[model samples]
Target: MTELGKRIVNILQKKSSWESDKERLLKEIQQMEDLDILQDVWTRYERVQKNPDISGTRNDPNSLLAYYLDITKEKPEEEFKNEKRRTYGRDGWPDIDMDFCDDRRHEIVNFLVGKYGRSRVASIGTVQTLKSKAELRRVIKALDPEKSINYTAKKPDQSGNFALQNEILGTLPKILKKRDGTLLKNLQEVYNEFNEFAAYMRKYPQVFETAKRMEGNISSSGIHPGGIILSPVDLSTLCPLHTTRGTNEDGQAGASKAMVTQFTMQDVESLGLIKIDVLGVSTLTTIDFATKLVKNNYGIDIDLSDLPLDDPLVLELYNSGKTDGIFQCEEAGMKQALQQIQINSFDDLMLAVAMYRPGPKDYIPQIAKRKQNPNLVQYAHPIVEKHTKSTYGIIVYQESAMHIFVELAGLTPTEGYTFIKGAAKKKPELFMSMKARFIKGASKISNKQVAESVWRQMEPFQGYAFCAGHSYAYAYLSWKTAYLKAHYPVEFICARLTEKSRRRKTDIVYKYEQDAIKNFGITIHPADLNRSKLTYIKIGEKDLLRPLLIKDVGDKAAEEIIRCQPFDPDDLLYSFGMKVGGAVNTKIVEVLASAKMFGNIPKPKVLSIFEAIKAGRQKSKGRQTGNLKKGIKGTVKRRKKTLDLDF
Candidate 1:
């Protein structure tokens, strides 16, 4: 083992006891003060030990060590005083502030498993419930004993057999809308418009009843996309464990057979298991690759966390609707909204992400108008203004609602958080109970009339809302990505292409390529067998597409081709096949040749050379087989003659 590895192991082994190990570990870590990285680790470890409830640490040695080593170092506490945030769950879990790349995130996860043992650390599972449409279809299938209704229609024309049910269920919006074109206004209005469909529904009322009963029922169980739970003891002692096979967001099967808790995230959390979101974000991967490219190609090292959040070029890119690959700001609607908002500050970016959802989306125009004319923005009361001023007097975030409850309603921070959580989750009982308490409390601080208006303002937040801290975290990443794209277009585009090239359809990468070439004036060279790596690479001012992006070239073959570069066609084929331990087929060579990857070599010539190499290998194999057969026959004859003589 390396010196560092041995030192780490030694530090871990000097444990006095389970409860006393913190002090021992800190003392041992302090001895390694000369190692700056270990000193940083010791600092974080000391902080975590001092405050066991520090959000994200969970007091587990593994969690503390991972947080200290992998998480991005934060600035002093005073720097973050202006932007206060909340931690909803137990302290010491991963959040957006960590800035972990996909690989680093997985590395931390693996470290947890190694530290706690696989049986004690497992990813949390989630239960997928049946939605309205799925429940309706299932109930219809069960009700129709003769299978008369063909509800699974691909087109409107195919709905002739079950037009009434299909049209009503399929055409109706997921969230009921009023005649005035506002969502969640009056749900009954949706059923009132079903003229003929009403008759069909009345005839089969049992179907509707069964569907309602089945809706929201657990349909299947799968591993949570990111949540990982660490048990204080063996996980099997708390919950049942099972192996689930499925792909993650990256469409990878490495975690297909990962052991997961049979219980859902809520179940594990309710059981007091410490859970952390170990999400694998492709944007972070893109940023990592982009920064590496910038450093290698331009000899410039970039610290994304330290990037200027108010760069004019980055804001201009957002305002000009040039955010095709920016995180969270790439959607067409988001881009259009950015053109109106003209993001100038980090707060604007935070509001943009927080307000781009369904409920808050409707208020975009009002927010934009307020941004354009600040005099038009108004609050129900001065207290409400304190919280809403940041969002242009608009309740664009859940934090705004929480602040309203705290400032206007005179509720404690904990109560305000509860109210916001209940409202965001649409918990009718908790929401109504909190509303009554809020009104009573507000009557003491502010008038009931103004309080009622403030309450109404917060009502829309129930539809959709995001935590202020989470929004800020995402906006920070979005700004970082935008900054990179604006200043380092070639590197950013190459990184985006590299990350997105793994998808089945290259449409996203293709669109990025078009923008890079047309908008950014970055030349995209075709994949070169000699120059192209496994991923897109920046060469001077031009970006070379990866050979793996070409059709019919698998990653293994591409790696082989890239490794056996600087060789002629015949030698290249021979070396590639020998290194890969497989045949270098003519089809791959033809693909490379067609892509103009072989310099001036024609496709026909490349194919001919490959075929000649294949023929020579076949001839050699035939000769070896013939000699082996002749030798075996002679040995058999000699053995028979010797046996006869012996007899």
Candidate 2:
């Protein structure tokens, strides 16, 4: 036998403790390998776990093997079963399967829920089981007239649908338990689960929080669309973690935040993983989409790729700080910040990109004064003047470190770049090695003191150090978004509002709607099946696009609404004869109607959105609730003139 097989046999013999036959254990292992199940069996075997033994053998490996296969085989069947049930309506309201699937059976859902808490499990939006449980629990609590009331119930203003579901689920102990409601245990109560998940969080908080925040949570208010999931395994297997996502989907996956590219260097080495930043940039998409419209509708394919950097109008917009509708500059505070910073050129945009964040935002005012008056800009050393003159003597770009290395340490351009990336990733060991190499390789005066000063400066610079190329690329995008916001604001806000509420609660969505209404003075619409464009589409009658286009609703819903336009369906999946709407799609439609998108179509359709309620139960179809849910609407006089394209 091969040494590997011999070792396996030897280990099995030792585990049996001379009572169990060696040949029997070896045969089991061989059988497992032959069935392509050795890895999973070994993986579980190596992992110590506690559970009631039902197979009547504590040390018998065969029981474990059987359990492993049973669970694994159960996984894909569950997945496909859910997948096969969805029905796509013509109006884009595709019936998403409200079911959870696991690749491995081994009580994976239970283990994950026990480890992460059911609420978090549901929040990630990946699993339907956890979502069902959480919703069931939520309803039981919500409608318990004896317990509490945060918001009024939709129907009869007396009975909450969630409350009713809670009652139904409370009795489910018998229905669910193979014994007593399948021994209904909250994943949290299953071995003190949420705390266990929290412990795991404590064990790997940086990675956990980073991974969690990157858009997988279905319960999360953020967008984790494209049916693509960026899981912890992929993250662990990829790059070192960082602060944030890029402006859109694909770019949202990887780490290190803005301006960093896939170019491998000292940063990746220090972080112990490849450093590839997938920037979640939506402005790029919006710009591309808008440009396509401009090309097809207006006959000018204004190539942003070839557009000259120094446009007077673009500069004037940047200089004025009317960045309200601008991509990076939409926040009122950002506008105030820009006015303080007095951005003038492409280089100014670069600095603006870096200084906007929490870490380096303090420098904005000082740099603003410097930019407004050239004489005020101070230089720590000649290197500062040399490197930062483009950004008005401010160290915004990570390139400053490279510049310092070249000017002071006498290193090559390439080596300086590597050193900067290393420092930025907070890799002290790699920095030390780079320091040694630089010290050893220097041809002329390599005074340790001066080199040490450069190193000290690089320390603060690393945390705030954004890639120069990324800033430049993003500055262009930021400026473009700002331009659209400023010039075509109606179109801009419509798109911006529909980005879906990323906060944990529906109230966050409310807050965003309020912001759009109060701060930006935009007319809000309700989510309606008829009036709202599938996604946020710029209506010919209005200067703005529709918020329905937000990733919250897909082209499926939009197409449904558009294609079924004038063929208004009351509830989601009405075409499919379903009472309860698709979970997310129903919400988006309701939101669009609330925004008043359906106001112009018909009186029945234009009824205030507060009238809409998700009155149903999410069941084996993922915990759903339904009943005549309702809300109040403030009276607003309709304008005689319809909002039309002003441009």
For model 2, what is the alpha-carbon lDDT of residue 192? 39
In candidate 1, clashing pairs total 6
**Per-structure clash totals for the candidates:** 6, 71
For model 2, residues 94-212, the per-residue Cα lDDT tens digits are 11111111112224333433553432221111122233345434434533434444355553343455554444445333323333222433433421333434454354344333433
Best by lDDT: 1
State the C-alpha lDDT per candidate. 0.65, 0.45
Looking at model 2, residue 636 earns an lDDT score of 17
Task: Output the worst ten-in-a-row residue range by lDDT, candidate 2.
Answer: 76-85
